[model samples]
Target: MPKAELGSTYWNNRYISGKTGWDLGEASPAIVAYFASQRNKDAKILIPGCGNAHEAEALIQLGFTNITLIDISEELVSTLQSRFAKNDSIHVELGDFFEFSGTFDVVIEQTFFCAIDPALRSKYVHKMHQLLNKGGKIVGLMFNREFPDGPPFGGTQKEYKTLFSGKFNTKMDECKRSISARLGSELWVQFDKI
Candidate 1:
């Protein structure tokens, strides 16, 4: 149940207008730190709603060989496709994340979840479950505070616990020490599929 203002077109418009406040310009520091110690260099990774795909770029540099990035907006996809054109290890697609099917060892979430309609949070949880291989995890950040008006919709830890509990074994959910500008305002999460 997506809210009217948070539909694909709404997001598309955000991209079209260059109004993406969530774009971090660089890969998230927290994700970079997590991957720094990662032993698996060939794991299949998915980054749904990947805006500029800074994370995918970082993963490529880390020697990752399989990375898939998906987004519903063709506008953003075109730009990213061009950006990642020379990278054989990264695949970019324009499609709805919920309908995209694939198996991955790691699915990274950035500002995506909070940008969608709150009613669809369960769908997001279930979709992540469906896309991941057993023991695979979703690692990244989620907003810890609610917004006044949003495609940047927000929620608390309690809501996330109920949203993800049955489908995933929550491994970590706490404030991250390395978040940028929005310090102390984000939840660093790592939910492994059960």
Candidate 2:
């Protein structure tokens, strides 16, 4: 159950108004480090809620050929399509994350977790389990603190661990490579689908 109607209209308005304070403007340093260590540059990677698709840009720069970027905002997706128009290695889609389907070797969880309604946390975990290959992992950062109100919702390591328990061999800890502004407040998560 959703507390508010946090749908495409809500997100579109956010983008249309430039209220995206959560857009790190670039890929998270922690995610970049994870990508740097991956030997499979051609591995299928998906970034849901891919505002600005910074990680895709970083992935392309690292020679990764298969990357997918999905977001619910038509306004943002239009911008993304233009940004990567010349790059066939990147494919961008405007749609809902839960209903969007694909198999991915690595699903970069950049802000997607905290951005959804808290009630959907379990659903998100289930969807991740379904989308991943057997050894697939969801990597990147999650805010390990609470917010007064959110779409940009926040929570602690314990809650996340419990939510992802059973389905994923989870690793949630404070992110050392997070940008200075989010440092100490974000958890560097690496959950391998079980």
Candidate 3:
């Protein structure tokens, strides 16, 4: 399918139809470990394409004060709005990641980068750079392999390095704490905006 076809309607339908095979139903262990090591509980953090927002919940538990979540699916965002209504620390918005505007100390990437069309990878990098404050970092997992064709599109570390080189400084390695299904296939990346 063309990249434009994978917009909000497509994603909302996926959520409505229960086709979200990518939903892990809980926070990712690697991300959780990274958050636990952080001393700053008040960092302004953004999680774009934040489906179900498991990481946001994990952040709340860790005492994070300013968490923002944006997703293309209105259905998912509605649910998130309701879910986080009582928590002032978390903000939920329905919008495209590329169009959303914000500056954050940290951006948590999970399956978001893979969910976009491969053609948009460069745009994704730029948007990430724009969303982060100076010295801000993007931290999380990216698939270290390929898919047939996907919302869970996969990529290699070499490609990722080249893609991000001009915009950020990166540290990537095999993720030791990935869930069993993704173990050895996930790369834990920390990209600091330059």
Q: How do all models score by TM-score?
A: 0.94, 0.96, 0.98
Q: Global CA lDDT of candidate 3, please?
A: 0.93
The number of residue pairs in model 1 that clash at the backbone is: 0
lDDT of each: 0.86, 0.89, 0.93
For model 2, the stretches where C-alpha displacement exceeds 4 angstroms are: 1-4
Index of the highest-TM-score prediction: 3
List of clashing residue pairs for candidate 1: none
What is the descending lDDT order?
3, 2, 1
Give each model's clash number.
Answer: 0, 0, 0
Candidate 1 vs candidate 3, TM-score winner: 3
RMSD of each: 1.6, 1.3, 0.7
- Candidate 1's residue-wise lDDT over 7-109, tens digit each? 5787789899999888888999888878877989899999999988999989888888999999988888999889889988999999988799999999998
Cα TM-score of candidate 1: 0.94
TM-score of 2: 0.96
How far in Å is the alpha carbon of 35 misplaced in model 2?
Answer: 0.8
- What lDDT score is found at residue 168 in candidate 1? 89
Off by over 4 Å in 3: none
